[model samples]
Structures are given as C-alpha cells and as structure tokens.
Target: MQGIIHLWSLDATEPHELTTETLGQAQILGCGSVLHLLRTLSWVRTKQNRIAESSTKLWLVSRNAVGLERMQAQSPDSSRQDSSTRDSLAIAQAPLWGLGKVIALEHAELWGGMIDNPEVADVLVEIGAAIVSGEKEDQVAYRDGQRYVARLVKSDPLAFDGTSLSTENSYLITGGLGTLGLKVARWMIDQGVRYLVLTGRGVPSIEAQRRLDQLEEAGATIMVANADVSDGARMTRLFQEIEEKMPSLRGVIHAAGVLDKEILTKQDWGRFRRAIAAKVEGSWHLHTLTRAMPLDFFVCFSSTASLLGGLRLGSDAAAFMDTLAHLRHFMGLPGSSIDWTMWADDGMSLPSQEDGKFEDNDWGGSDKLAEYTMAPGIGLRILGTLMRKADTAADAVQVVVLPKDLSYLQGFYGDRIPPPLLSELYRSESVQPSGSSDFMEELEKIPVEKKRDHLATHIQSQLNRVLGFAPSQTMDLQKGFFDLGMDSLMAVEIKNRLQTSLGCKLPTTLAFKYSTPSLLIDYIATQILALESPEGIVTESKRAANEPEEILNKVKRLSEEDLEALIDEKVRF
Candidate 1:
C-alpha cells in the first residue's frame, strides 16, 4: 500500500468506525498523549527504512484538531455574516498541528497529510478521498460537514480601521516589561489609554523602567505588578489589586511566554513544561480569572511557530494559546489570537549580534525565510485591527498576521514549493531547479585527486550561506561547527542542503557526529567514492568497514514496532 492511516481518539475503547454526531466541543488539555504519539512517529521514521521510502505515505487523523469557518447553505437573497461561524476549537490538539507542520517541512517524502474531522458526516469517505486525491494540500479540516483547507493569505494593515482605546478603562498586559509589552504600552499611550496595568515575573530592568516612566509621563496611570501569570494565587492577587486601585479591567493582552528550543530526541518533560508554562497554563489562569468580566477585548500574542512550525521551537506546546483564544470566542467572549512572526526589535524571539542590531543578512542566517519580521509599528497596527474586529468577527479569533509577499518561504520546505495551505498568499509559479543530477555529473568530471577539494569547497559554500559569512571568508576546517556559534537549526539546514545537493541519505545527526568541516569532508568523500565505485563492490565493503557506527546508531534509535518487526523477521527466517 502507498499510504497508512492512523486514527487517534481520546477514548481508545471506542470502535474505529465513524459516527454520525460530532464528538464534542474542543477543549484545553494536556499534551501527554500528543507528545507520546509524536515521539513514536519520529522514531518510526528514523528507524524504519521502508516507512521512509518515497512511495509510502504516513497519515495522521485527529478529531476537532483545527478551528475553521462552519459552512452554511447559502440563501438566494440573504448574506451570511453571522458571528457564530465557528462552534469550538480543539485547543488540546494544537501541538499536533504545530508539530505536524514541522514534520511536513523536515520529512516531506513520508508525509501523507493531516486531516481533522468534525465527526458530523461521512468521515471515512472524506478522509479516503483526501488521501487518494494526490493533492499537495496537507492541512485539511472539516466543519459542519464541509471540507475546508487552511490558507495563509496576506491582509493589509490599512484595511482595518484601528480601534480606539478608552482613556477611562484599565488594560492589563502580561509580560509587560519585555520588549513587545513596552512597545504595546507605548502604542496604547498613543491610542489615548489612560489606565494601564503591566504584570511580569520580576522587577523591571533599568531599560524596562525607562520605558515605563516614558509611558507614565505620557499622562497615563501605570501600575507595574511583579506577578507570574502561571501562578494562580499571584494572578488572583494582581486582579484584586486592579479591582481595588485601578479602573475596571476593560481588556487583557496575554503576551507571557518562554522560549525552549530542542529536537525531539533531546527534549524532556521539563523543557516541554517550561515551554508551555506561560503560554498554556498562564493563559488558562487569565481565562478563568476574567471569564466573568465584561471585557472589551482579550488578545493573546502567539508565535508563528504555532501556525508554521519553527525549527526546534517546541511549536506543539506553543500552539495552545491559539486554541485558548478560540475557546474564549466559542464562549461568546471578545477573544482574538495573533500569530506573530519574529519582531525586528524583539530580542527575546530573535538572536542578535553584540551591538543589538540585526545582522545585515536576513534574520542573521538563522532563518532565511524571516524577511518579513514584524516591526513594532506595524505589529501594533495589526493589534489595533484585531481589537476592532474582535466583536464583529468572532470566527476570526485565530489570525495569522504576516505582512507583504510570503512566496519566498517555499524555499524553507524540502520540496521547494509552498504547501497548498499557503496557495492564496504565495503565488510563485516558478519551475523548481533540479541541481543534484548536474552536481553529481560535475563531481564525476573532476579528477580523482581533486575530488576531495571540490567537495570541500562546495560544503564550505553551503556552510557560509548558513552562517552568514562572506563568500570570500574561509571557515576553519578543523574548528567545530558549534564553536562557530552554529545552532541545532543551522546544523539541520547544513545537513539538508548537503543531502539535497549530494542526492544521498545522510543521517539526521550528520553535523553532530562529524563535528568539524575536515571530519565531515572525509566522511562525505568516502560516500562519494562508494557511489562512483564499479559494480557496487567497493560500496559494500567500504560501507561495512567505514560506517559500522551508522548501523549501530540506527539500531539504537529503533522504536518498539521496529524491535517487534525484527523479532518477526528472525522467527520467519
């Protein structure tokens, strides 16, 4: 079979057959099962060679995993502009969608697709047709018995007439001492907001204090509360203080989050919990505390990692905020979640040079696709747009806000083509260049003595592109990759670039094992020599002797199913 479908259910005892009624409204839950399944799938891909073959596709099915506009039968003379276009969102499954995006990027060959069913209609038939249709649309959601595909369309900031912040009402901003918080505070002041309550885990730094003072000087009454949003007692106390001293809470901006970056193999529960502490738990506290209040708007600042997974950003956990926003809207509350790309001035999200300014290159070579970093001015304008639309557009609670053209992001994927989800935003129809064959032919034309040098130069050029080094600058062949400030994402990029160029199946931990350019050169040279060997005789002998550790690594990375498969094969033999 070309495809294998795996169905995930909350109640495992339930039969695998489809049902007529919807399962239930989406909820905000933990990620224990989600993480387990992701870990298993990751291992399966790494260990099972057949599963990773180009012809085989792996599909994951989830219920109520995505939030989409519910379809209504169009009337002849009436327009459908109802506020209840969405029923509920499965916030608990946000991690699956977030991580799935990353998987689609990292393993496009084995990726079948992600299908979210509402369970209200012929779920089996819809899923079967989706898989067999040979379409590039990987992210699909069914709502009200209608099929809907996700799209990342461009929205103009000017299209939204900005909302006015009342001078008499108080607004609470979590993580208010950080860069984004202060920027929003400044914007609020500009919008004529007079009362502001800003909360953070600790006392503000000198810079934060300076910004706070600036806001106070602008004729706004500001309250700086040292409280962690994740702590229920602390959040309650802060709300009490606001009740006693400040004006009635009119709005809330949930901007609290912590960044945790690691691959699945390296991730632990502690890291995952830290990543979701402020994003999920803190948002929950805010939701429960303010559910009774008649707020004008409730905004949550989410990352693009939730929508389009970032490399090693723990995007799965980060996606909970999106679901939380949807949950609020489902309850008829004024809620909106803004999935923001990296901010130009936000140091917490983007790595910067010692001078505090971004490098001349795009995103300092960490992410070539981040040319659309949201500037403070533009981001706040989008926030204003969201605030204005929160009441009228309840179904638009989850908004993926990115400015300008997004076609260049296609380069970020392994296929060098934008996923169907981004078709509306990315209109690039350029032909994909096939360079691996030409590269191999050039390698064959090179003399045997100069092959190593040629490969070295090519590897160095790719490394230079990743590291943002000038083309003329030479990287030390003996120096370690990590020592040159290369991160895990950079390592993955280098490995992917080489794998694509060389047309070889390199290990996922390629840079980690090789460590240095000189060492990597030797290993790659051997692979090239083996590929060019006569009758595949030298390839077999050299592979066994020179790459025993690779075999051992594969064995070490085996999953439970892999071990079971091995036992079955041994019994058959």
Candidate 2:
C-alpha cells in the first residue's frame, strides 16, 4: 500500500495510502503527470520542513523535454495549452530546486532531484539507486542523454532572397492588425508573398485597414480573419477556410499575444490565463491544425523577457514561449523561437514622444552601455534570416537576436554574465563617450559654488543625447521633468548618467523627487559636496562610523522642549 506507483501501472491497483514513513523510505517518487508532480513536490517540501533529517528524492519524469535550457534554447509549436500550462508548471517547479538546495544545506542526509525520463519505469530502479546512494551531483537530471548548453557564436548576416518566397503560397499571420504584425505582413508582400491571411480577435483599426488597403493595391491578397487563436474549434474552422480559399498555406507567423504588465504577486489566475491564451493556447491550436500541412516555416514571435524576466513584466508569457520552443524540438517540428530584444517602432518598446516618435528605452537609460533596440527593418531582416536558416539548422531550435553592442549590459550584469556572451561582446567595437576622463576630472575640480552650474550643463548634455534633442534646444530650468517632455524612461536614463558620472547612489525616483533641472543640479551638488567636503559638520564618512550613536546620545540627554528646538534647527539645515 505504501509502494511507489509506476505511471503505466496507474490502473494496476487501488490508490495506495502514502505515509510519511513510506515516503521517507522511498528513494525516488516518480510522477508522469505535472499535476501529480506538483502535488508530490509540495508534499515533499512539507515533509522536508517537518522532518529535518528526512532524505527523499522526487523524480519528475516526462516523455517530453522540459528544462530551463531546453525551454530557452528550442522553438516549439505545440498545442497552446502545452506552451502556457507547461510554462506555468515549469515556473511552479522552480521552487523544488530551492527546497532541495535548502534541505541539502540544512540536512546532509536529505537528497532530492527532478529527472526527465520518457520511459520512467525503465530508469526507475537506476534513478532510485542513484538517489539512495547519493550519486547525483546536480539538482536536475536528464535521462534523454541530450545536454542543453548555451554558446555564443557569431551568426553571419543573411542576405534577403526575394526569390525564395512564392506568390502561389499563402502565409498565415496571427495578430496581423497590430503594428508589428502589419509590419511583418507588409515585409512579406515585399518578399513575394502574394497571399497573406492576417487574423485577429476584432476588426482592424482604421489605420491598420488603411495599411491593408495599400498592400491590396500593391497586388497582394490580404484576408483579415476576426478569430481568436485560443479558440481551438475556431482555429480549426479558420484553417479549413484558408485551405479552401488560399492556394497553399505555406508558412505561419504566430505573433498573437496579450501583454499583461502585472507582476507575478499582483497577478490573478484570470490575468495570467488571458495573457498566455494568445501565445500558448493559440500557438498550440495552430500547431495541432497545421501538423499535416507541408510548411516551409512556422515562427513563434517570442520576447527577450523569456530570459531576462523584466520588472513586473510578462514572466508567465515568456515561460510559455520558452516551453513552446522545447515542445517544438521534442516534436521534431520545423520552427525556431526568436527570442528578440526590444523593437523601437512596435510592441512595448518605449513610450511615444510628444512628436509621435518613439524614444529609445534600451539599456534602461544608460549611455555607457550599447543600446539594444532594433529597428523594424532590422527585426524583419533578422526574422527573414532565421526562417532561411531553419531549413539547414535542424539542431538550432532557438535563435536569439541581441544587439551587436552589449557593453551596456556589463553595467547591469557585471561579472555574472556568461563567458561566452562576454567573449562575443568584447569581439565587437563598443560605443565610447566623446568626453575624456581628464575633462571630467577638471570639471569635478571646479569650486563647489561653480560646480552646480557645471554639473547642470553636463546633465543637460547627457539628457539631450538620450532625448534626441539638439544642442540649441534650450530646456527650461524651472519646469518639471514631465513638463519638459521627460517620462519615466527618460528619468531612468538621467539617473543612470548621474550615478555613473558622479559616482553616487542616486534614488530611482531622483528625477521625480527633484522635479526640475535646477533642483536636480542643486541636489547633486549638495550630495557631491557632502561626499567630498572633509570639514563638513556631518560628512557621510563620520555619519557611517559613529554619527548615529552620537546623535542618539545627544537626543537622550535633551529635555522635551530642547529636543523640539534641536529638531527644528536640524530641519532648518
């Protein structure tokens, strides 16, 4: 009744009641189902906490390849549920490693690891022996014999061959009404794709319709389908309709997805479900329906968030795409998950400026690093290149297109960046400031009173570069940042510049707190003077050492009335 159940032997007997003793005795608890895996993992975590000395191994064996590396490296076009569900499940599984690590650290006798084996029963004994003997070195083990490792290798720029695409072949593009989708559609037409089926949940916007009309006028047939990709039945029917009308469904660009900005803690199940439906469920539906069809390419439009996990960003959505990539590899499908960085014109790249132009939000506002924003043309070209390479590169499941310039990322990642990436980053020429270190030193050496004006000028110059403003564009010193056309993105860039140049740990809200250029300049000067001044009343160095203790002792000795008067004087300063 306490023995482990083989996945294939689910119907062999009635469900056995598992006790803590039984669970502890069992070296490996294998679960084929993700649900069962999660349940077992939770139970193990509880048991580990409850019984400090318990050693248990939870083996999560799946027929499909599932891991961070597999998910990150491969592009897969599985059922939409597979992508979203698997991704959510994968993320949910991440805590198991943490639990295992903690258990290992706290109790040397405790051992646990996740193993991915298609035939769980075949390796159950071997895995169990390994677990019992404490032979496994890593927390996660793969039974498939394939290793997933990321290597930074320079990909040669691909030439755009217009002759490759055929007019008789039709291509399906989900989210075609959106800016990026529309751009891709237009680019496809230019590349000799005469028939294009663009699908979205609603009617195209007036602007999108106008663009579609222009494409139609250019002699390309554009069919806009008002259908949701998450609806499997609707997708099936839509594909049937396309098969009937179109000459041939040659390719598909799965670009449909919803952007949910809520952080994981703030996000509800509904929000996560809705955000993932378009990318995960939709892609799954497309893959299921189009598996029989002979297609040249099937591209999943994924974001770099899949790897980076941006602040309050789409972690769930990224995981779905990563899982989709792994699923595609498992299925031996012809597709690549392009983990793309930010694009300047479309998507959630940057907020639009007052003149309707998009500002660069790359490098998180640091000019010291290389900008990572890709133009629409450049993005399209990369996509084209990836599609062409997909045929020859069977092992290449994931294609990450990063900015050639990566010096800026060093500021954020520092030594944590992988050596492979570092090698590639140093291989290319990085952007350097025109201003010399000697010039900056000379500016810093100016009289404290004069330093404020010099710092303001320097700050203004840096702001102008980021905002794409000319040297002659005079900024109002009294105006707030918002009034001066400075947004959150711009504010961040300004803060980064100040932190880097002045060597001060400025607050993220520095721009908003100061409000104006003159105020910010004054604040910076005060901080710089406090840092540099040796004879100042309350220098940072003194404050760090014994100022707090001294202040507390002085406060304790003062009377109520005297304390109030002392606080007033301190506030005045």
Candidate 3:
C-alpha cells in the first residue's frame, strides 16, 4: 500500500475525506468510535481488565486523531500502542460473555459466543491495541490447511488498558481435548503461552488443525495426543511423552465431566457410579500423576452439582462432588498436597428446556428454580477466586461457574450470547414436537414396515392422538406450528423417537409442532423415504431418560470442536 488511505467522520453526513492538513477540521465524536471498537472487540476478545471497579472488555486498535496527530507531528512513522476496554456493567454477563456494548462510557456487553476461549480473547486484545496504534500485525496462521487474515482497523484510545498476565511456563490440561479443554488450550496461547499438549479422543479434523495453526501462528506451539485422563497408565505414558517433547509444564486445567440423565434408580448402580470416576476420580489421577512435577496452579473444572449437593437427577454424582470437597483431605496429591481448582458449570443458573420458556417479561414465574440453579454457580465462582489465591487460603483454592439465562440474566454477569441474538429461525411446524414426551411409549407405536408410507401413517396417528385431530394426506403447516405450541425442546424429543422408530434421519424440529397430524406425517414420510435402512423402534434404557444415541454421539464429536463451539454444544438432557 503506497502512502495511506483515510476517510471517517461520524459528525459529517458523509465520510470526510481528510488529508494531513484538513484532518484537524473533523469533529470529535465522543463515543461513536469508542462504542464501535468495543463491539468489535467483543467479537474477538474480552478484557478481564477492571477500571475504577468495572469489568470492561478491551481491544487494542489503531490510535485516534488526538494521539495520532500528536505523534505524526513528531515523527512521520509515529504511532502509539493503545489499550481499548469496555465495561459491560449493565448487559447480562452470562450471555454476553466476551462482548462489550457502548451506551454511555459506563459499560459494554462482552459477546458470549466470541470469547469462550481465552486464546481468541487474548489475540483479539492484542489486535485491538495494534489497530489503535496504526501498526500492522504479522500474519497470524490458522488451521484447515489455510490462514486467517486479520487487519488493523483505525480507531481511537479505549478508556481502560487491558491487563497482561504472565504465561511463562507450560500447562497441562487433563481433558485437554474435551470441549472446554480445546478452548482453554488456545486461550493459553492468547495469554502468551508458548507450548500446548492437546490430549483427548479422536482423530484431528480440518477445524482442529486450523485451530492449532491459528494458535501456532499466534506464537503458541501445540502438540496433539489422544488419551483418556481416567486411565492413569495412559496418562502417565502421555506425561512421559510430553516430558520428552516439551518439558516445561507449570499448570493443569481439569475440565472433564460426565453427565447422567436419571436418578440412581434409573441406572445400574455400577453404571451410574462412573460419573464419579470420570470427574472426581479423574481429578485424583491427574493430581497423583504430576505430584512431583514442577507445577504452579492446578485448575480443576468441578461441576455445580457438588455445590448444590447434586441435583435430583444427578444426585448420584454426590460422591464425586464429595471427592472435590475432600481433594485436600486426600493425600499423595501434588502441589501443596491438594488440588487448587475451579468448579465451573454454565453460570449461576442451569441451562434447561425452561431457560427460554419465559413468554412474558415478568420472567415467567420460574424465578425460584432459577435462583436455586444459580446459587451453586455463584458459590463455584467464589471458590475459584479463593482457589487462585490458595497460598493465602486454607489449603487449596476453588472457584465455581454455574449456568444462567442468556436471554434474561446475562446482564447480571458480563457476557452476551451474541446475535443473531436468539437464533431467529422460522422453522416449519411439521418439524417441531413435544420435548417432554414419554420416550419408550413413542417407540412402541412404530409400525413394523421398512418404508416411508408406513412411517407417515404412524406419525399421522400420533399427531391425531396428541392434538385430538386427524388429517388427510396433506394438511396446512401452520396447524402444526403456531396453534400447537411446539418449541426447540419438543422438537428434540420428537426427532429422537422418530429416528428410532422410523429408522430415518428425521428433521430434529418435526416434534415441536405439526398443527395437524396430516402435516407432521407428510414431513416424516419425506425423511423416511430417504433412509438407507430403517429399523424397528426398540428403544433401550427404559428406566432412565437416557440421551438419544445420536445425540450422545454428537456430544462426543462436539468435545473435539473449538472452545466457542464447546459452549454452543451445551445441552441439558
């Protein structure tokens, strides 16, 4: 690029084309650019920085006229590195996790989907600063056999300078390739971490490679290994391998977890006990494995289940929760003889089929449940803060993260779910179904035919029963959608049963609403016809509302995606 290109003025009707001499004529727009910069920053990073007691999102962007004009007058190539931060004091913190908004200089909404991973957050911050100073950043590499190109857009100074944390030593992630694991993996890079050891199950995909590339380009070298943290022998072997490759290891991030669908009665006694094995027992494995190794902090991702004494459905996990509570009580553990950890779930609330169920602004009368759900989350957070300061606390530090309503309570925290705010989808009603239906009963009704017409008739019958209306071969779609009250939750349930009985890939939304049996049957017929091999619906796990096999598979696959993807992969059975 020859000399330079500049044109901007919020006060003018059109962008002002200013040269070095006339640039001074431009009017200063108090917070226009500031707000825009903050929004953009939320898209890529979130500032953990605080100013005068406000947690703001920060970005380092190109300098402004006030600073740039002053610098150029001194030197032609003159520019200054700047810090940009936004305080999202008002927006729902949980939803806008990594975004900031500019209403007044008071606060910003840290976009949630964006900064789920710390690495992405860190890089965005650095980029924001570079842009503010009018400097070009080096090419950042990306995965998927390509590179992600980023540019420095012109912007003014941010009110608060972002904080810089030291990332000198190597870190170990127990569930290194799990959902949170992958995200935290790259986040380490953003904070100036140098090397990474990725441990998880499965072969790396294009996106996974791209992440490694991006992190590496951002100066974070990564290594990939597939191992189950629950297997101490394999874990020991992995550490030995890591020792041979990249020796400097300092921290451990334990974000692995196991979720159950029913109360203890619903599952085999031994089968349900595995939750403890994977979560709590796994933590012990990591603690003992690296006990003598040189390490700093051990961050374990405990669930809100422990704090809430576990839930009705997940109460069996109490033993695991107890393990965390007694991590310090257990001996032979490394780093102060106990694990310093962070217990995290979604937020103060739990993500359920009901999180989005409030039809009226009065919060839909679920405040009590929401309060109960969020309590453990707050406790987890407090524990985390204490755990980080473990040396000053009792023996170890512990923090917690609970779930919250993105649509309602994100403002209370410092995160936003990001828009396209709430997936403004206009789905066909034939796709929607009742979410909380009896799972086994639905499967029992499937006809013993291996064709679309058979499945179509089956759906027609079910629709007639549910809505108390029969239909012809074809019916109006609105009958299934609007009048019937179908939603995302119902859609999931319907689809699961449909796939099992119909032996086809049913649109997940079909169960939400069919207005009329006729319309829903029409949709099922189409999908049934596409099946390669439709099987008779013989659902298992009768005692428990176990996750649909397909859904579980999807979850397993999701544990391999990036951090943000991990956050998005969240679902409550």
Candidate 4:
C-alpha cells in the first residue's frame, strides 16, 4: 500500500521500483486507451526485468463504467434523478468494461480487476478492502454501500405475451441489405409484418435482391431504400420518405453495423470512426428521429464481442456498448440491445475446415470460446419471443447469450476455475455432466463388426440434434455433410462431439473429411477398433451377444418412474 502507483501521476521518465499493486482510473477516451494503458504498463515492467515474475496487479476504478442491475432505480432519490442524462455520461465509459474483458484474457497476469461506482456514495474504503483481501471478482459495482457483481444466467424462453406485428403498420429495418438484416426481414414477415422499409447505404447484392423479391411475392410490401443511417440528413429524408409512401412506422430494427478487425496498436481513429458510425451514430439518429412515435419495439442487434471481449474487436466493442447505452438511457421507447453470439448455419462465410481448423487464427482472430453458436432459426425464435416482452426491455436492457460449455472456456482462461463472470456457467456445466466418457466405454464394448453400425447411429443422432430433426428422422447416409444442410459451425460442433466421446484428437475437418454418415462411421469405428488390435478384433469377454438385453435388464430393475427419467437423460435414441 505504501508504494501504490497511481496511473495518472506515474512519471514514466524516472522509473520507480515496481510495487505489488497499481491503481488506475478509467477515462472516457476511445477504447484504444485500454490497450495503450496495458501496453505501457507491460513495457515498464519489462524494462524493470519484472514483467514475467512480478506479482503486481493493476486495478481500474471508474464512475459508472458499466451498468449495474437496478442501480439507478434502487437509488434513494431515483424519482428526481435525470436518468437519461446520467446514462449518456455512463455510455462514454461503457467501452472500458468491454475492452477490459479482453485485457483480462490477453494479459491475465497483470490484470487485477475493474470496479464501477454507480452512485455518489463513497466506496473507496470498500474498494481498498476488496483489493487488499485478494477478491476474485474482476467485475464489480457499488451502489448505496451495497456491492454487486456481474453474472451470466441461463435464459429460459419467455412466452409470447405482447401483441403481434400489425400487418397494416410499417416496420423499418436499417442495414436491411446485409445477411442479418434480410434474415430479420423474413422473420418480421413471418410474424405478419406486411409493410417494411429496408434501408442500407449501398444497393442490394444479387442474393439480397433475390431474397427481397421472394419477400415481395409473399403478400408483403417491400421498399428497398439506399440510405446510410449514420448520415443525419439522409436518415431524416429517409424517414420522411417512409412516412410519405408507406404505412405508419410502428417498429424499428437497427441491425446496421461495420466490422473492422485490427489489434488496438494497429487501429487508427478513422477505422474506429467508420466502425462506430453505423451502430452508435446511426442508432442515435433513429432515436432522435422517432422518439415520439408509437413504436412497439426498437431492437439494436449487438454482438457478443461487446459483452465478452474479443481480440481485434475493440472498435466493435465500443460501438455496441455505446448503442446499448443509447437504447437503455436515451431512448424512452421499448428498446432492447441483444448481444448475440456468432450466428451460424445461415449463409455467413467462415474459415474453411479443410486445414488448420482448430488453430487460434482460424476463428477470424476472435477469442470467441463458444460451444454452440446461434443458428438463424433459433435466433429468430428468440427475437420473436423478445418482441412480446417489450416492457421488460428497460429493466433487462442488455441480453447476452453466453457460451454453453465451460471446457471450451477453459481453453481460453487456461484455468480450472473460471473468472467470476463465468462462475455460474461453470457451476452449471459441472453439475450436469455430459457423460461422454461413459458413452465411449459402452462403445468400446461393442463387437468390431457392429461398432460401425453403433457409431453410425450415434453420428446420426448428433446430426439430427444439430439440424433440429426429429429423433425418429433419418438422414441420407450417401449425402455430404454440407449437402445435408450442415454448415461450417455445425461441422465444428460435430467434430467436438466426436472428440469428446472418442477421447482422441480428431481433426477439425472430421466432418468434411468424412463427408457423409457412412464414411464418417467407417473412419471413427476403424480408429476405435484399431486401438484395440491391428486386426480390429475386440475381446470376447467385452463383446457379449446378450449385451443389449443386459443393458435392458439393468434398466428394467429401476422403477417405471425412474426408467422414464433415464430415457429423458440419454441423448441417443
């Protein structure tokens, strides 16, 4: 505590002895500052020859750096407070939390944690105690002397409780020519939105135009307007045009965004501005333009990058975080910012699984450690469900879809115990064991000739699950994985499933290489049987002819009630 170096006052020229602790305050400067500060600290430590061995921890303190649940509503003087003004100020600091998460992942040793003071109440003493006691929470906030931590909880699907989209009214979708925008457009039409205004900066692509024609043929009115949402004058004119030609605008989906991938050191202000313009400035224009309209929902499509930071995504994090603040604080309408994970199984282009599939760089240089990416069908269902719960959007402003597996997270965090934010997810995955090892053991007991059939059955079951097919449905064994509607992400998922069950290092191109169920089963069975003997022979003791009945009898001993639960637990048919 004696030599605590304050980040603001630290003299870089005259090097002081590195201490065990350092304190810094987060500024409203662009998210690049996060990288800048950490880089500077690391440089200083390296110069002192203590970068690798030092136990020094850097803690960042900020006022309203992140939003705490009910922090404002729970305040004593909430009624008189100007919530919008406070939230706008909070928006500037929101990027710190997003970028700070990346710093934690990339520079874990030097990272202490981030603390947000949401209220005027002094928590300096509490902050010191938390740091001095080696508190594990990396993201914490204080309000009215009460401490709060960020947590990710499983979101059970909410029932549709609001009115359906009116066919007579108009819905506006920004960035409507893009993949996500077009997907949402189709979903809106499915929900009975007959009149839609789809706006984008450039003319639609051939595929985009084809989809537009399909929507038009389906008894819906489609207006494809070429206008940049970030341009204030253009946006105003677009709104005027919409009002003049279409039905009254009742809903808006601000899916407009620009993604530029670069590390912070290589990032320029122009790149940051271009990325932020579509999401931040564009959303602001939409809010100001339609603040008084009777809009049912104003949904901002955000990425998981903002909630759980990614490498080379600092600008995206800043843009999405600011947009979230704009929706929650600035927009009084029914607005929600859903931070969605990678959308797969649609037409989104991904790295080829043919070679170097599991390499870190293969994932577009992203730190997205996810078990399951969102499929368009599932994502659209979630979006539809959220539309009905518009009233709760203000309270639960940010809805982030978390990774399903803790083990995938371990690959990034490099620890058995996850950080505080992911602790809940870790505990959930821990309690509900996947039972993959048990399946493998059962698989090894099968006769060599029958192992191929069993493996095929297992692979079929997984394919069914991924494609959302009924358990009884069977896919063509001769068709390729992609031909059977499997995308790149789905291929990765199948590979992970196989590796876990077989307990071997399967290639990332497992699905693609095998290409079909028949080939896939043959390869997997050969690999497993080869481990037993060169001739692919299993021990007679392990392969009993009555193995199936033995398993049935083992199950029959349980009560009928317990038998039903067993069936529910088994993922295989």
**Index of the highest-TM-score prediction:** 1
User: What is the per-residue lDDT of model 1 for residues 1-573, given as tens digits with 9 covering 90 to 100?
Assistant: 566555553432221231111111121222444445556655665566332245656666666655554222223422433233344355555566776665565555556777776463444554466567756767776544456667666544346676867989999988887777877888888989999998877788888888888888889999999887777788889999999999899899888766544444345556666556676667777888998998988998887766666534446645666776776777788888777776765433521111122223323453443455667777777889888777658645877766566654533443345666666666544433354556777998986546667778888888877766754568788987766545455666687678678876666456655778888887787754453323344566667687878978888899989989998999999
Model 1: residues with Cα > 4 Å off, grouped in runs: 1-9, 12-30, 44-58, 70-88, 118-133, 154-162, 311-314, 346-370, 414-416, 427-450, 467-469, 472-524, 528-573
What's the lDDT for residue 68 in model 1?
Answer: 56
Model 3 residue 133 CA deviation in Å: 70
Q: Put down candidate 3 lDDT per residue, 1-573, tens digits, no spaces.
A: 111111123232221232212212221121233334443433333243211222243331111111111011112332332222111111111101111111111122221112211244445554465446633222222222222322212232222222122465566765555434555566566656787777665555565566667777888767777776666678879888888888577667665555433222123435543444454345556766666765555555544332222222122232233333233323323222111122233321221111112222111123323433434334333333433443333334333332332232222111212122112211122322333335335544554343445555566544332222343333344453323432222233344445544444443224422335555665445433432233332332332345677667776665455645667667431
Give RMSD (Å) of candidate 2 vs. truth.
13.7
lDDT by residue for model 4 over 1-573, one digit each (tens)? 211222322121111221111101222243545556666665665466442323666665565445544232323553453443344334444555665665555455566676666343333543455458856776776655556677766666556554478989999988787777787898888877899998877788787888999999988999889888878889999999998999999888777765544443334556655555666567667866877888877777776666455533333444344445444444455777777766664323111011101323233222132244566777777777666665455543666654465455433332123666665566323221244576678877986656666767877886665554554567788976655555444454566666666666555345644678888877776654453332445455455666988998998789999888878888565
Q: Compared to the true structure, candidate 4 yields what TM-score?
A: 0.61
Q: Of the candidates shown, which would achieve the greatest lDDT relative to the real structure?
A: 1
Candidate 2 off by > 4 Å: 1-149, 158-163, 262-265, 311-316, 344-370, 389-392, 414-573
lDDT for each of the candidates?
A: 0.65, 0.54, 0.37, 0.59
Count clashes in each candidate, considering only residues at least 3 apart in sequence or on different chains.
Answer: 0, 12, 76, 0
Question: Candidate 1 vs candidate 3: which has greater TM-score?
Answer: 1
Question: Clashing pairs in model 1?
Answer: none
Off by over 4 Å in 4: 1-32, 42-58, 70-89, 118-131, 161-163, 311-332, 347-370, 392-396, 403-406, 427-573
Q: Which is superior by TM-score, 3 or 4? A: 4
Model 3 CA RMSD to the hidden true structure, in angstroms: 27.9
All candidates: CA RMSD in angstroms?
13.2, 13.7, 27.9, 16.7
lDDT of 1: 0.65
All candidates in order of TM-score, best leading: 1, 4, 2, 3
